[model samples]
Target chain A: MPKLDNYRVPLKGPVHLADYDPAATPFAHGTVKAQEKDLKMLNKQLAQLMRPLQGENKRSVLLVLQGMDTSGKDGTVRGVFKTTGPQGLRMATFKSPSKEELSHDYLWRCHAVAPAKGEIGIWNRSHYEDVLVPLVNRWITPQIAKQRYAQINDFERLLAENGTTVLKCMLHISKDEQRVRLQERIDVPEKRWKFSLDDLTVRKQWEAYQQAYEDLLEATSTTHAPWYVVPADNKLHRNLMVNTLLNHCLLDMQPQYPVDYPELVGLQVE
Target chain B: MPKLDNYRVPLKGPVHLADYDPAATPFAHGTVKAQEKDLKMLNKQLAQLMRPLQGENKRSVLLVLQGMDTSGKDGTVRGVFKTTGPQGLRMATFKSPSKEELSHDYLWRCHAVAPAKGEIGIWNRSHYEDVLVPLVNRWITPQIAKQRYAQINDFERLLAENGTTVLKCMLHISKDEQRVRLQERIDVPEKRWKFSLDDLTVRKQWEAYQQAYEDLLEATSTTHAPWYVVPADNKLHRNLMVNTLLNHCLLDMQPQYPVDYPELVGLQVE
Candidate 1:
């Protein structure tokens, strides 16, 4: 069951994080104990599609991830939201900004934590780190990183015309698997508070952040937010390819459960 | 291992929510499959003490919970944080208070999501429902519910003198177990969007919300935030007594990890 349209990323491209093969496992099929028992049966079918996507509070999903430093993105969000528990999950990490989140407009702190309306939202490192750290520290300008990739594809096409689904990934790893995960986070003294000397000056700009992630994965692969590219050097095939691309985007958003409640169908709670 | 100081709530006197026995499973010792294998080994040792309490960013833990209306507080936060996944967990959920959270105060949207530092916050129906739905609908007075239980014990002793470690819980179910969980959420059509005919007008003011939870568990049981009545009608002994009182307050806050990086000790990541 591999065709995640062969790791997407092709909206008419010139994108080459050197033709992707971060130790490829094309959506792993069998053994690593059967892709961790199919990532615990797609993390209990993403905790049963996050309870009718938070009891059908209309719609929202987000995801986003992106990667590189230890290319696991907090181990694919703790192995694909280990049973979607932090109730309707909202996790937003985006570090390196605060001064009142650089006084706005950097998608204003990723649109002030986006996923609402029955939430799932998980960014971790996003708003594509404002065009990959100001276009790999030339502090912006490749025409302001192509106008922040058409203003992040017009702010993810206004969150997919207001019902939000989004889902992006990148995780791709290698450059000798990030020098063996930044030298096992400096010989693992409980992973030395996730090592930094600016992660060895961003691992000496590993080929300029892989050419600023192949020019923002070829200017933000769009059709209302599409990205993929996740081979992530097998941390269980990057948490079984981002939990099978977020259980194929919540089984194509079949989130229901909001039963109209015909006058509480023979009501009685006395 | 029952003595969580015999279900805590004692910082001085009279808190009889009928002396707590909502189907008591004194922290359920054996078999319900060995207390669901000791709640999956205390949810993997509380996800390994949430990575050194988020790499010792310097203490924090909140919790809160409170109860009634099918007293399971989202199934004890989906069974004791089903393996702490939403990175360093923050939760929140308060519910009724808008018009800009009833124009401030009522612990101003719970001191704007309190747990910062090395996070673990979770409220789920808190600021003790601003003193239980305005002192059980008399809508304030009882001297502003005794000045909001001494301003929620000086706002949880200013989040326990700023390093935060609160811990509240109250879950204690049984008005015939909330009439068999509100009649299995009205005979379950995918639990009919969690049925609410204002949950039967708060189940006909259940003894004035159990005498406003026996006067806020006898005036906010303190010693800088303590309160635990938790019998909770055996939903696996209310998730093994709030995951064994949050793994005994993260093993008495033994959160360490920030190893003062000695100039990257023989450092080399190139």
Candidate 2:
């Protein structure tokens, strides 16, 4: 297995999307079947870790997933968290901002849904969208985009300073891989609901979007909440890598069941 | 397996808690191991049903759970929903009302969190707590309790008429069962956080709470939203019964993927 740190974007350097191979499966060390079995085991371990995390009730984890359409953000969530109890996991999906949301600062909506202590919050598309979408469409000036990057870093630092451990992943997929996935969505009848004409409009700006991601990822990768770019063309590899990243974060936190109630040690219910 | 309707509280009749046996495993048709296997199958089917439900995005389901302490509400959620994707399931846990909550009508907090279209909402404890706790403690007179029951029925009707299928389950466990479960929480260090001295105070009013439950169940069991008394003393049996009930409900709803999109046929992403 490759070192996870290799995937982490360095805090002080430029990040080139070309350096990461979307088709690489560095974390999958064995045959396809074996890699699947490992994903199942990792999922169970994650479920076990969730109990103590909720019991401790003093810290939280936030997983920010940013990816192009058909890059498997939804699939990653379903695959990785299939074994977890719904009570311990909170999921928020951000699409085009509503009028009310646009009325406020972009960060305002994200902050309102930030994970509370003792919960693991999943943001399917997050505040980073504020930077990505506007920049790709030339809606925001480059200077304004740079300012937003610093603002986002400060926002994440505030969460980390308080008990949140933020783990962000950019699901990196090749343009050809995206073409295949988008075709599947269009061709499959049951998946037709997920297909929107707007996806094509966004796909046309693929190169511009890639450039925006590269710039924002370099600017926002911080000591407190660094970004890890996951090679996501292989769907199973994407799930496995994200699950492993989350499991590692939880283990490091070392959440334990609270043990401070001396008064109830021998108390009997009526 | 026993007929599920046998457990349904009738809309036109009085509900007698003594008539139900908490320890009976009517739904557990075979050996313990076999029943456990069936639960796994049911969980998988529920997970399958969730996708189409979300794809249709027109209807929803709300599951309301109410019971005395140690009746296993939390355990039921963890067991039944273990296989579900977190995105499709929205869980709301209502504890004691805050000062702001107290200032509003009892149902305000519940209304704010009702499941949106295409989601399954689980209430760990619910607005029924308003009827249960207050009436048991004599904080509300019988007349007001009757009024609240009517109000609750009307509130649930609005949800059903608007496409939310409501399923309420009362986890009925005997006093002896509660004694054992509460003791386990005290004896088990990891579970100690769940114990409270106030649990004992409430247990002392067990008969009063039971009476309150019977009265409310009879009054609130409407055609649109009915209540099922789940036998919950045997933890495995409780899980099996609830899972089966939910599976039956979802199957009856017959949620399907939308077939209305004609604009994208043979359309290719550029």
Candidate 1 per-residue C-alpha lDDT over B32-75 given as tens digits, one digit per residue, 9 for 90 to 100 = 99899999899989989989888878888999898887798998
Please write out the lDDT profile of model 2 over residues A138-197, one tens digit for every residue: 899999999999899999999999999999999999999999998988888889888888
Assess chain B of each prediction and give its TM-score.
0.36, 0.98
User: How much of the true contact map at the interface does candidate 1 reproduce, as a fraction?
Assistant: 0.79
Model 2 Cα lDDT, one tens digit per residue, B1-270: 588899999988779999999999888868888988998999999999999999999999999999999999999999999888698888898999999999999999999889999999999999999989998888999999999988998999999999999999999999999999999998898898788889999999999999999998899988899899999999899999999998999999999888877787778776
Which digits, one per residue and each the tens of the lDDT, describe model 1 over residues A13-57?
A: 688877888898877886788888988999998898889888888
The 10-residue segment with the lowest total lDDT in model 2 chain A? A261-270
Residue A45 of model 2 has an lDDT of 97
TM-scores, each model vs. reference: 0.37, 0.98
Prediction 1 global C-alpha lDDT: 0.86
Clashes of 2: 0
